[model samples]
Target: MMASSDPAVIQTRALSKRYRTVAALTDCTITVPEGRISALIGPNGAGKTTLLRLLAGLARPTGGDIAVLGTAPRPDPAFLAGIGFLAQEIPLYRRMSAADHIRIGAHLNARWDGTSVRQRLEGLGIPLGQAVGTLSGGQRAQLALALTLAKRPRLLLLDEPVAALDPLARRQFLAHLAEAAAGGGLTVLLSSHLLSDLERICDHLVLLAGSRVQLCGDVDALLAEHQILVGPRKDTTAIERDHTLVHAVRTPRQTTLLIRRNGPVIDPAFETADVSLEELVLGYMGQHADGPSPAHLSAIGGDQ
Candidate 1:
């Protein structure tokens, strides 16, 4: 891609971190378009957190390469300068107050905007005089966020940033991400098991399940491609074999199906409705299930 189209962040072919036998990520090729908010979501061990770590350059990729702002990681000044990372459990000096932490943030980030830092936290109603160790989980997350935004990053990689918060607090934190991206063209890639929270903030999705990418694309496009059809139960054969079955449920009276079809459904017995992003994602993840199902979600990783 030309520099104009070149994203500030990219992973040409990033594969990394196998724990003796299991591969965390295998030949993961992807990119983050400049200034867009992308969500990397997956189940507990789906390698979502692992990918976030690699992107932040906290751990070396076991096999392939990754680039941030056109540079490599770990003390790569330009890359480090342009990225602001809020790890899963952001570390803080136990004794430091919110105000003191911002001071430390100012020290590391070359472009630290002190006034902006204070204003952001104050705007959020986070008391600067209180010590980091004294803050609640949600408050601490906000504090970490305050430190990160204070850096004026070109890219922000957040991992379950609001996982510890209540519903209301979650809203407040996500709003911060939205404002940051809109006002300054900040590219953000966040990972969360909280699909609802992510759904509200992300424009793009990267769904990971079973340690590999299942789907990747724009949120609206995926929802448009797959569909849910509700109607009478058939012998599994008569329901319409035209579409690749993504998910199927059989009740005594009727059946609901999720499918990926090349064209329109011609089945007269079925009533088709557009699948929500959540349903589209669940269909992909449930493709191989023998009987039961766990939770499912969507990103934009593309056909499992």
Candidate 2:
């Protein structure tokens, strides 16, 4: 978890977006500290894309407030220069070659580093002169990433960047992404459904489900705060009274629960165990699959 003293690179308070008949996001409040690789995970249509669009200044929020790098996101050159956004489709000119894209990037971006980007593509064995349309899906994804990184943006936003790639290609893309993030001075908010992949490189977590943030915090701290309790099928009144229940399952003779521990579980009937990242995420998702209960909404973790 980031210390309270650390400066926030991204902050949102009661952020929301609506499209007439549909609400894309609602009351999302989270703070991402500078230089942290944060994972934004949620099921499809959970407003992950809408949130990224809002952060990138591509779309305006219907309500609430947002701040990126100490100011609201805008379309101005200075603000755009400090942020890079790569949508799921990996927008690029398919008719143009990789070199051509680099040339265009240099002209459009004030802080472009075409030399480094070209070298990166060359090192990957990607043909710089070939049209991007002829390249593999993996190659195009890499080229888009390289161009985005070359801008030297303070914040990077990626929306399901590797969803269409093969396993090996996904691994390769993440390796390159990990390398870039290791250089410091970069704050990344990556949206992906691959929990295992996100766990490998992300320290901070923002879980959006049912069009709202269910959990947002440091992965380690969140893990430590939650526990799985397995016990005989019995009345849960006492357990519920002592802890914040995130999810529960009951069989004929056993009852298992995922709970945010409030204090010591002094009851001898229940056995406690640590929860994994996947378990924690699924538990919360299952709990809020229909929509968050009033109690669950009030107990959301992390800032706001």
Q: Which candidate leads the pack in TM-score?
A: 2
> Would you list the C-alpha lDDT of every candidate in the order shown?
0.75, 0.90
On residues 1-304, what C-alpha lDDT tens digit does candidate 1 reach at each position? 1223645465546566786798988767666778668888777788888888887888787887777777766766667878888988877886889889877877777788777768877887878898889888878887788788888888898988988889888888888779878986688899887577788778777877677776666677667767888888775454334555667888999999887666888778889998887776666666533432332222222233
- Cα misplacement distance, residue 43 of candidate 2 (Å): 0.3
Mark the 10 consecutive residues where model 1 has the least summed lDDT. 292-301
Q: RMSD in angstroms, all models? A: 4.2, 1.9
Model 1 spans > 4 angstroms off = 1-8, 12-14, 235-242, 288-304
The number of the candidate with the highest lDDT is 2
Q: Candidate 2's residue-wise lDDT over 1-304, tens digit each? A: 3455669999999999999979999999988988889999998998999999999999999999999998999999999999999999998999999999999999999899999888999899999999999999999999999999999999999999989899898999999999999999999999987677678999889999878888887888889889999999999878877888888889999999999898888779999999999999999888878465675665554324
Candidate 2: list runs displaced more than 4 Å.
1-3, 290-304
In the predicted model 1, the residue pairs found to clash are 16-62, 205-300, 215-300, 215-301, 215-302, 216-300, 216-301, 216-302, 217-300
